[model samples]
Target: MKINWAEDLRERVHDLAESLGNLFVEGFHYLALFAIGGITAWASVMAFLGMVEKGHISVDDILLLFIYLELGAMVGIYFKTNHMPVRFLIYVAITALTRLLISDVSHHNGPGMGVIYVSAAILLLALSILVVRYASSQFPSEVSAKPRTRRHLVIAQNRAEGDPGES
Candidate 1:
């Protein structure tokens, strides 16, 4: 058979372009991870310094440290497995709400609208954790050992909620 050199060249160029695109995306991912890690480290150090200036650690300081630690862990997990769970984010948010609530009670004149908002945020984060757990169990990506898609989880959740057209 006569060779189609032009078609072969085009296919090779396409594959090379795809590979370069993937490489660039992966490189950007790692760069982001490193940037996050560095920023978290800096924030943790600054928190520690602030605590020192205050002569000791307070509840708010501790909570802030925990938030920073959670952020670092989130980035680390994403770098390692690329399976960063939403639960980590929810946990961070709950901790932050707790911190805010504490700050509001201590620093404000009295109980104000901030308390209500933070309390509601904590409740919402808790509910989100529950929803995430249910989704993981009902449509387990780990147990099935198959390539699961976000569409699967959303469709399943919508079906269960009687909102078939949600997606």
Candidate 2:
């Protein structure tokens, strides 16, 4: 019987390299998400403080806050599920366009072509969100479409084997 030492060493090396690569990618994701989350929080605080100093919340101010909220929610959902909800982005865009429309109207004292264009854009974005939601619901992906972390796999296994342990 021949023991292939060279092949064994090569296989070990490949696996070690792959593990290290995965570790690095995971660490990078954590760092980036933390930074983004922290920035969103800080910006929200600053915006709130600005509104307080101004002594009144304008339409634009409220809309800006809504944008921040949507951003925070997006970051949180991505952190928890690792799935970026496209609807959140569409919500942000809608909020931003509404803000712009409000700003334009207030500045111009009346609606203009810009208002029409912005309104149309917002409507399109809303329709796109509806389409996305309908498509996701009507054509759900395979179970494997979602990335299964070790924790999720363990929970699934527990449920499958009737362990009744931590799910």
- What lDDT does each candidate get? 0.85, 0.88
Looking at model 2, report the run of 10 residues with the lowest lDDT sum: 143-152
Residue 107 in candidate 1 has what lDDT?
A: 89
Off by over 4 Å in 1: 1-3, 142-167
Q: Tens-digit lDDT track for model 1 on 35-140?
A: 9899999989998998999898889999999999999999988887778878999999999989989988988859888788889889988998999999998998
The TM-scores of all predictions, comma-separated, are: 0.78, 0.81
For candidate 1, what is the TM-score?
0.78
Model 2: per-residue Cα lDDT over 91-137, one tens digit each: 99999999999999998998778888999999999999999999999
Q: Cα deviation of 113 in candidate 1 (Å)?
A: 4.0
lDDT of 1 at 117: 84
lDDT of 1: 0.85
